[model samples]
Target: MLFVDFTPPAPCVGDLNNDGVINTADLAQFLGQFGQTVAPGTGADLTGDGVVNTADLALFLGRFGQSC
Candidate 1:
């Protein structure tokens, strides 16, 4: 038997709520911050442009349902 320790990356993208999963909750949070300049650490702005817009939403949607 072999047991190798593996650590996942920190702060997975698309995980707005930091719940380790990208789902409706993240989508809801994104929608809530849509068209607004959210803070840098909010994670709602997928594009990292300080603002949550269609482009960011599109990017987020592409990664929907993915697990961190």
Candidate 2:
């Protein structure tokens, strides 16, 4: 017998709410924290650059309509 894991990976970083989809809600969330660093609970830093800026915006735009 063979064992394997078939579970899909977690949603993209853009899915800020972990809602399994990257949509307006996530966008709103992203915008809400667009100028701050990685705070206690905010997660809008899509590029892991320690700050939310164009880099993270670009990455978020890339996955704006993604489903995961």
Best by lDDT: 2
lDDT of 1 by residue, 1-68 (tens): 99887876666778888888899999998888888887754668877778888888888888899997
Count clashing residue pairs per candidate: 0, 0
Output the worst ten-in-a-row residue range by lDDT, candidate 2: 39-48
Per-model CA lDDT versus the true structure = 0.83, 0.83
TM-score of 1: 0.77
Q: What lDDT is obtained when candidate 2 is compared to the true structure?
A: 0.83
Model 2 per-residue lDDT tens digits across residues 1-68: 99898988854678999888889998999899888888543499877767888888898899888886
